[model samples]
Target chain A: MSRIAITGIGIITPLGDTLTLNRQALQEGRSGLSSLEIFPTKYASLLPFGEIKITDKELKTRLDVTEPGVTRTTLLALHAFKQAVENCGLSASEIQLSETAFINGTTVGGMCLSDALYQDANFRETGSEYLNSYDLSSVTLYIQQRYGITGICNTFNTACSSSANAIMYGARLIQNGFVKRAIVGGADSLAKFTINGFNSLGILSSAPCRPFDNARSGLNLGEGAAFLVLEKEDNVIDKPVYAYVSGWANSNDAFHPSSLSDDGEGPYLAMQQALQVARISPKEISFINTHGTATENNDEKESIAMQRVFGNVPAFASTKSNIGHTLGAAGAVEAVFCLLNLIHDEVYASLNFDTPIEATGLVPVTEYKHMRVEHVMSNSFGFGGNCSSLIFSKGQKAQ
Target chain B: MFYIHQSSCISHQPTFTGVDLQNLQPSVNNQLPAIEPKYINIPLGQLRRMGRALRMGVGTGITLLEKHKADGILIATSNGGIEDSITFLNQIVDYNEGRLTPTHFVQSTFNAIAGLLGMITHNTGYNATHVHRGLAFENVALDVTMLLRENPGHIYLIGGVDEISVRNYRMEAMAGWYKKEPISNTELYASETEGALPGEGAAMFLVSNNAESATAKLADLKLLHTADENLVANQFAEFVRDREIDLLLSGESGDSRFKRYYTRCEQAVSENTAIARYKHFTGEFQTASALALWFSCWLLQNQTLPEHCIKRSGSKTAFNRIALYNNYQGVQHSFMLVESV
Candidate 1:
């Protein structure tokens, strides 16, 4: 049997752009969230967001892309995608191989320019420049056309679980012998479309989110993108691997469109099935990167599910407390965080924590600690009750 | 191998549980709206709030689930809830995000309909939604293949859905997707125009390893991102190398620039193989190929050919082996092979 290994990783989030900056912020327990900047919104001063600092003009100029309707969503995806391929040491010819695939996921595909699109749709003139860019397929098509990637290409949208499913699909492609490697991840940029949508749900927290805490009001919406290059073991050879994708499973709650069941049936089945796929017991998992969106409904349900899976719950923390919930990109971002925990042999603190929820009485790791992590599980639950879980283990363990 | 245990669809043609398609014909109208089912059994409160896409999807799925139970659900849509999305976008602009309501916003999610089906069916496994424009259905089909291959004995409910929104129609027409000049849908091929007529529909299928009651067996499938005629021809030849193809379903829309590709395919294949077209009756959308899939299964199982769909007759009267070739705006190309066992 061959293992699917993560040969490269890249990210652009509220914490930082480079891996070094993100690591430093994690060590110091710093928060990447702040008042909305660079984006125009009525709630700019009234609410906080996980907005990336780079302006749209700077992004376009730096990326050398001057397309008229090119949105921030596409730009952010390109930025992270470039870093991931470059880090994987994939050469030009190798990138064009028939067996190298590209899979991406995003709910906010090109709609980051919602206002512009709305205005463009009302006009009585010729085709608008933003017209072509507005399609959900445009982002992946642009990247494939630019790099000449001829292998299998696809884009998925499963709400918050988009990227996690993207990663799992990539791994499945490799495992099924359809491809030798796959570049997979997702992207989403903060825009009024989602902000207002989430605002209407009344799930936006006024302060930094507090996951696993009793008084946790709601979540803070974030913007970011992340990508990981997964390659078959035989193809990777002696190259450095961040970790091996050990197991994965996906399920739906079938209870509600936005909230999970009271008993967390969906999350329980997903985590339980993932462990079975990994061929490990719940005791083998040393840490967990939870889908703790800090929303009152999610945190509690996730806690109960955790207790059901692990009698003595493993050490777990929600990174959203630091970077906010990145929505479509949350899965891959948190997966990369799990990879970091495996590589650095340490776990970071979950900030803005005070008291545990009365129902589960589970307290997340509120302080940074050095530990020898072996296997870790990352959870990502999304709207429409879409739930998924992935397990990653130290690379050496694969051999 | 995965076989289709059940197949159902709701399209512009009168295709449903027991509707005979002998009366099918191409229309002169540019827009091919789906023929919605009455769904008399659905509760009034729930039926009143559902959108067009939801109606076609859940309506068709419920019809199939009555006879079969699916453990996994997968759906594909190019523009999910476009009506709701347009409403939300306009609301944000009209109200400046201050007086926004959650109705359209909640329903605007691309996977909203798929999630609702999961809730109704009480299916909690492998819920998936693919949204890669014209290739959405093909992607979901490939996913179903992988999942079934990994775990046999489980059945999957898969389908493709898309609905025409007024705003989307006008905006996409401005982008040169639909015909600018009013023309007959039947003349879609004769007109030397640059765009196709807009259409929408929903089609569902149950795939499993069990072939006892199977309609057709999925033999082989492949997806490509190429436009070179020679490469496509070579891949097509290799796809049907050892197999005998009795029929080939072409997904050529009426756009003048893309007519050559279908012509090229016809020229590439052996003359003994019959060729049929579906886009003329179904119009064109991202997931329009779904209607083609349902049609293929129906033809293979019933061994009947509708005069409206047949462009040419082949040497073999029975379609033992069939292939579906489609390209979306010359970007996404797919080849699906089905067999009668």
Candidate 2:
């Protein structure tokens, strides 16, 4: 199989708007979990959120978007998409080619404007601009419409693992000869719909989330977007390859809606299958970016899953502690973090970690350090037991 | 060759168990709802929790799984379980985000149907749901074909489902998604209108790479995202230039904005090439093409095209090849080719 190289990356998160900004924050170990800023809600000051500090207006203005029916979700996605395509130097014609596919992942589409939609749907006499943008396809549609993207476009909603699956599907499309290039990623924004939805599930923590910790309370909701420009290894000429997507897999627990199985069967299968695809052993893997959401079930199950895979675990950390679970964007954002690990030859610290879980007795890499990095595993487990893991190897010429 | 071994469809027509869409009476109500079967195997408690979309999707998907085991489950839904989502959102507003119920939120996610299928069938392999409007089913079908190519012997249960959310329907009416003055199914094509009649249904297919006793093979599928007039007029011709098309199942909603694309397809084909329209039998929705694929499979198995489906007479009497062309509001377009085993 020919390698699928990652030629470009674009990310916008609570930590920062640009990839460079986020890299610095990851090095400094700054936590982006603070109270909500742009969204006006009663829980704005009460609970912690990984809300992007920029207002909707600022985002729109920066993106030069003034179109109706465009939501904060679309704006976040467009921002990262533009940066990614630009960084990869894909022309408009190349992007519009039928061989160029656009696969997007988002759980929160236009629902970011749920309040506006509700206000217009019931009270107002006329329809609001947000009526068409409230579904899961709105963000991808907006990007497609704006760019006249005509290729195989798709929007996935596998709960939080949406974007990870998006990336995997893109690579599969390339490997299977469906498309030569794919722009794959996801974007989500802080919305009352999700906030209250998570709150109803009683998974929202008041304090900043501490993933992989013994006393980790719960996950803090976050919002962000990231896009990876993946091209068949043959086409990425003279481009600085951050990393190559070597292997990826998706496995379901089939256990519970919100929780994984007792021994993390989903995670174990996903990680094991991903390793088999990558053709690398556990000892060869330098770091594992765990999906430790700090929720009572996820962190422990994920730790146990790791133990089953690698008996003596390598340096592992969950950056969700730095920036709360970004739902759809977490996978791609953390994929970029993995690329950063490979490109910069370093691993960032997992913040707010005091002690390891008693059951696993495993401690994460607590301090940032330059290290020998070869292959990095990024894991993302979403609601509905959709567990996925992707392995990135140091880039080389296509075989 | 990728083949469909078994299938299930819950449409407005009674094609679930008896499988007789040919006898569907002519009534062109603007909104076409699925004539669902009695969900016998699904537990009543779980059914109570599911909204229309969830029940219909999971019901049909699980049925196919009961008959044959699949390596994966891929679902296509444009607006999945929207009513539940609306209910959850309304509750958040009504109760001021206070003491809210969690079931609605849990069941509202687009992939909830796929998740439920994994739990019930206990077949947890590659699970996915595609939510792109119009392209939902088509894209997922493409995904299934790719998965089959990657792993040669895998069978997948693929489905496309959607339910009418009264709130979303009403809201879409404001944007002219439905006709201002609705008409009956008999008068759908005759009555001049710019909008389509809202419709919803669920369709499931058991597709496998190893085709031994397959009903129909999905030979080729293509999409035309550009509404370029030149491309629309020429794409259908290009797909059928080599293959002898026995039937062309066209999804032409009565909306005239898209009538040109259908006309272009009709003009591209010969008079001997049989053409038929399906939306009149099953109203226009995002995943209606899935229903069309199901209908094509039925026609191949039964060796007959229902009288109501035929739009133009064709030369070939025996239908061995079928083509499906569908466009959603003249924006997203698809051209697919199917062959009988």
**In order, what DockQ does each candidate have?**
0.77, 0.73
**In candidate 1, residue B20 scores what lDDT?**
71
Angstrom error at residue A198, model 1 = 1.0
Per-residue lDDT of A248-267 in model 2, one digit per residue for the tens?
A: 99988888888888899989
Which regions of candidate 1 deviate over 4 angstroms?
A397-399, B25-29
For residues B1-341, what per-residue lDDT tens digits would candidate 2 score against the true structure? 37999999998888778777778555444788788788987889899899999989988988899999989889999888888888888888888878787899999888898989988888779888899888999988889988898788889999899998888887877877887785777667765769888788899999998678899999998876777767877877898787778888889898878888888887777778898888877888899999999989988888777777777777787888988889986778888888887
Query: What lDDT is reached at residue A49 by model 2?
Result: 86
Question: Each model's C-alpha lDDT?
Answer: 0.86, 0.87
Quote the positional error of residue A24 for candidate 1 in Å.
1.5
Q: How close to the true structure is residue B242 of candidate 1, measured as C-alpha lDDT?
A: 73
Per-residue lDDT for B243-283 in model 1, tens only? 77899899988888788778777765678899888887788
In candidate 2, the second chain superimposes onto the true chain B with a TM-score of: 0.97
Cα error of candidate 2 at position A50, Å: 0.8
The TM-score obtained for chain B by all candidates, in the order given, is 0.96, 0.97
- State the fnat of candidate 1 relative to the true structure: 0.73
